[model samples]
Target chain A: MSSPSRQPLLEVRNLRVEFFGRRGRLLALDDVSFHIDPGEVLGVVGESGAGKSLTGASIIGLLEPPGRISGGEILLEGKRIDNLPYEELRRIRGRQIGAIFQDPLTSLNPLYRVGEQIVETIRTHLPMSEQQARKRGIELLQEVGIPSAAERFDHYPHQFSGGMRQRVVIALALCAEPKLIIADEPTTALDVSIQAQIITLLKRLCRDHGTAVMLVTHDMGVIAETADRVAVMYAGRIAEIGPVQDVVKRARHPYTHGLMGAIPEMGADIDKLTQIEGAMPRLNSIPPGCAFNPRCPSAFDRCREEKPYLLPVERSQVACWLYDETGARREAAHG
Target chain B: MIAFILRRLAQAVLVMLTVAFIAFAMFNFVGDPINNMVGQDTSLQDREALRQSLGLNDPLVLRFGRFVANAAQGEFGVSFRLAEPVSRLILNALPATMELAIVAALLAVIFGVMLGVYTGLYPNRWLSRFFLTISLIGVSLPTFLIGILLILVFAVLLGLLPSFGRGEVVRIGWWSTGFLTWSGIKALILPSITLGLFQMTLIMRLVRSEMLEVMRTDYIKFARARGLTNRAINFGHALKNTLVPVITITGLQLGAIIAFAIITETVFQWPGMGLLFIQSVQFADIPVMAAYLILVAVIFVVINLIVDLLYFAVDPRLRIDGGRSGH
Candidate 1:
């Protein structure tokens, strides 16, 4: 138990995802690797199509067909989950790893009562009688801050407001007491005023349950407030990963730096927030050397020629040639 | 809830009155019923007397009012050709048509849903493709043609069943059923299939599309993530969601089966109201024709009402009151 505790709760190594389309095969995710420690929040921040949600989906083994994992290993508590049979994976899904999705308005089934959905989830992964499951389900609803949970349990999802529905969804995800929860843009569909409340509630519940969370979102403010560690993704690859504060304050990768700059500082009177010059590359048209090189502001000859992998830069692991010590010396020689 | 039902009831009543008026107007002009009623040898004076006694000379409005009043009282006057009360004639023919329609509808819905789920779930499998191809054929082929082919196969080539008529019916009170007798049950098989084939395919396609759409919803994905088994996810969640639309189509199709069982009944010579309706049309029996139309319209209106009510049961989103009572 101690040895396992020392190991990360979830490890994704060299994950590659591909989509087979009529035109040809397109690589969606390439050499993506990351891990989450027990009871830690790993915020995955990226623009849309950066594979932030895809990564979470791949972890949960729910990638829609025509898109599949071409290579990689996903392990939870040192057991390989990527290759498990569907039934085996299903058993592990809610028992060991659960998932919450975007759009709480559409997450819980509208046909069933709120409590029934949660109770069904609990019973599926755990050995409990219907009555016991219902009891546990009500308790979960209360834990997520639903008022009059026992009475509200029998109500349909539509009866609840957007924020309340999200609370229900969170409760459902946490009901099985899974070690990890893959929350893909969980708060992206909520009201702005309700966003912080949901985030705080999620943080509190996961902490209370000791459940590690892979919070995939594009909101930097959300990451700044909730995530313990942050991985900034660019073109389906992790551009930089470090302690949330370090990455936010002193971003090493140019892409990460541009993202941080894009977020407007509250009190600073600036003409405009910094904008990244070009869009992320299309999957089929990504440049050979580095995906971000064409759009990169500080692109050099080396950056345009050879791709960079994550290298230790102070506290963060940044994938940029500028942080490469040997490459810097070689650049000096060329200069 | 009561107000919603009451509103639908009022709408149903209005629709029925319109249908009744239309049927009365249309059949009233399908040539003179008096000419068909009287023989060539009958005297002109007797014919005039017959017309006067039948009140054909009454004003159109008064006649229409009388027709509606009699129809409302379940008295559709008398059939000119059979010289029998039209309502009684319909009552005698009704059991056979109803039994055939009910059997056919059950067959369509049960197998349609099963095949639909199978095709929706494993759309790429050869069996599913075969089912889809079969459904395409079912949808395209005319009902009479399908009935003839079924007869050729089962009755001619195999000699396993009778070719025509509702054989060996056992009367239980007034509702005679073919189910109790082996010959009656066997006789029913071909016509029921012929009647149900088109509706089965229609329902299959509808369910398949709905199932595919529902399977892609966030709730279904969430159900999968919640680690529900494929069976539970597919049937318990996806199938239930598909049922709202499925119910609407199924209800309408069931009504269609009853109304359009004419071709099937004609093919089999089945002693049903559709066959009676066809004979009445050929003989210019206006009262029977008008009654048949009104009856079919009533069936459609009642089915629509039932379907509207079923929506509240299947989908909670439409239930404005919410589940405050934990029902």
Candidate 2:
């Protein structure tokens, strides 16, 4: 754990992303909010359609066109960034925040030398000559554990193996020493064996640099292994958020509980790994009350009639009606 | 690289030999050059002498071999109608055609890629729509028709340019050029554009589609997330990626430009190899035709070789993959 004196590095409030097309409007993300303190690793876990990647993209100001931030306030170090002009946001991108994408192959420009790319990125955000940038780039490559960093600097992406290329991408993301790094499924595209190595590298890098990380992924195991705080998302809304240990050991929201149930224990004799009832709702047909209500096993009448907001529930924040006093009262009376 | 060029050169030489053989054989099938060159009133004995003197009496293979040997020495025999060295005619006419093609290709690439990149970037913008309309018009119109339209607009209506001939020629020992004077460039304008119109649109459409495709790739998204400026992402990343295909198309289209400059040259009365080819065909000038064929083939092979080398330079992936496969 880090010091409690530092403010949260990133704050997202009521982040709503919508896709507008000629057909109509589709709400992709609704009222999603979370914050990452300096040097903290916050893992966002969800199914494929849970808008985990979209939230990551929106925070990095790289949301694909037509799908945009319709309503939200994203602040980096207390300055609202969601509404800044493009140039200003661009300046903040490498200078204050960096991003690590999923696939290493596509994350790099195949036409450029890896060293030159890192150098260019360094030069773009920092006041440095080519020689200085090149020197720093080599240092970063070495820091990321690339062998013969100086010699490998002249090599292209195609010259490196997949794991080595991922290492270079990590080096590229860390070149500018940003306060925050948004990693969207950074290890999912890596080999299974190499995934842990990258995770450990990221944790070490963040810890050493005091850089906060927002790790987006659907792997609960990864969240458990690395994250300080875990947010479980279902159908574009966060079902629960809390310290990883507390949430994993004693889950609160039914959706989070179902997700945890699906992780097979080591050599445990069980009927089968538990399965969540239904697929995440499509953007157009997201249920009115709680997006997870249709698939929630403990859903009561109040869960269907009214949407619930995140509320403090003993060591975690839960959005389930079971945590609400009025909802609990109604359920007891009905029983 | 030198070894690669040498290998390519060897291949080009083989192709040129085959092309020369085809041209020589093709001549025998055409109407008798003597019948066209000499009047019908000429005595039969004299006509026979003319044919013999032109080496028509030799065996077909021998004749073709002689033609190839002379071509190797840069001596393309003599033209039937022009009664001059075929090499001289090509040398004299090449400058004008080359000047036209080079300027047109340069201008076409600049405008086409510029328009294509923006149009692909913003397909719905009014400027893109307008450029797309221009490209459509360019694609539909024939070169001769485009030439006529330019003449009407810039020549007759505006009275600002010339419509015929290669302007005033400035002879410079073994070479003469029309690009030496202001009037020469003025005359070249209408024809160069007319010849370049189709290529421009073809290149525009190619770059536009390539740009659109590259924009969708994961690298572009990754580049955006890296916080690259819009200009860097568009031109540096997207445009550089699009250039390979555009360069390829431009290379092939440049060959086509040289091939079809005949029509444009005829319409505008520009003195170039294309017009020379047209005149030689009407006169049944076999040597000139054979020489022009070989020249065009060499041009195409050389251009393609350049394009391949450029591909290796522009894309390191190509170099890496190609190097591995080469082993």
Best by DockQ: 1
Model 2: per-residue Cα lDDT at residue B310? 90
Q: Which digits, one per residue and each the tens of the lDDT, describe model 1 over residues A1-335?
A: 34754899999999999999999999999999888999999999999999998999898899998999999899988889999989999998888898889999899888999988988899998899999999999998889988898989999988888889988988888888999999999888988999999999999999988999999999999999999999999888899999999999988888988999999887999999899998998888889777899988888888878878889888789889988999899889989
TM-score of each: 0.96, 0.94
CAPRI quality band, candidate 1: medium
Error of 2 at A123 (Å): 0.9
What proportion of the true contacts does each candidate reproduce? Answer: 0.70, 0.50
Top candidate, metric TM-score: 1
Identify the leading candidate in terms of lDDT.
1
Candidate 2 lDDT tens digits, A1-335: 22546657898999999999999999888899888888899999988989999998888888888999999799888889999888988988877888888898788888988887888788888899999999999989888888788988988888887778888888888888999998989988878988988888888988999998999998888899999999888777888999999899999998888888999999899989999988888998988898888998888777888888898988789988788887677778989
- The lDDT values for all models are 0.91, 0.86
Per-residue error for A311 in candidate 1, Å, reads 1.0
Candidate 1: where are CA atoms >4 Å away?
A: A1-5, A328-335, B39-52, B323-327
Candidate 2 Cα misplacement greater than 4 A, ranges: A1-6, A330-335, B32-59, B320-327
Cα error of candidate 2 at position B270, Å = 0.9
